[model samples]
Target: MHGYTTDKDDYLKRLRRIEGQVRGIARMVDEDVYCIDVLTQIAAVTKALQAVSIGLVEDHLGHCVVDAARRDPDEGQAKVKEAADAIARLVRS
Candidate 1:
């Protein structure tokens, strides 16, 4: 666990937006919407999630990983490797 932090309000806003998108998707499903439209919304939600994940990863690297690297080279390297793995997974998805 890293001592990572972010603006609470911004995080909440993003979550709320994502929630709305999810609800919209549910509504589309209930209405038996077109296949393309449903798929587009699903893609939007996936992209949003990825965006959030990337932002957190960037923040962790900037703060936690940088701090750790300054204190211990090995720890910093480990953090970098972990972040790289996460990014690779994200890219694959």
Candidate 2:
């Protein structure tokens, strides 16, 4: 099982909340809400998503990478590389 299996439900719930926030932002745009207000909501959603990403990264490192390393050094290295690439992408974004 994945490292995050235990916390999957929590992640899904957080994602759903972020999704709702996005819809709300869209609605604000449609309603001609103040630009700063819309921007603030967007910022909030961005931070929420970043928090989720960080959690997933932690889970991946703690579970997947550790397990792979125990099972095979080569596999562990690959997982590390993969995770590093993912983190790089997150950083660039």
Candidate 3:
């Protein structure tokens, strides 16, 4: 794969933070925290997750998909299209 290399440590750090956020949300629910506060945390988690997903997709396109296309035009095109569709879905979500 020719994609941009992601720092595994960095990704893991983000995931751990997200996990903590999730736990915090659970705690908030148990404590009966305000609805708005809970929702705000949820939004933060959502944005964090989206960032990770976008980073992964971008890396895939920069490395694996592009490399594949370079070696085989048809396969590369298919991969690119698939990536585009995934991006669209991500955006819609």
TM-score of each: 0.88, 0.97, 0.89
lDDT of 1 by residue, 55-82 (tens): 7887888888898899999999998998
**All candidates' lDDT scores?**
0.86, 0.97, 0.90
Q: Against the correct fold, how does model 2 do in TM-score? A: 0.97
Candidate number with greatest TM-score: 2
Q: Is candidate 1 or candidate 3 better by TM-score?
A: 3
> Which residue pairs show collisions in model 1?
none
Q: Which of the numbered candidates is closest to the native, going by highest lDDT?
A: 2
Q: C-alpha displacement of 28 in model 3, angstroms?
A: 0.4
Clashes of 3: 2
Off by over 4 Å in 2: none
Better of 2 and 3 by lDDT: 2
Output the lDDT of residue 10, model 1. 71
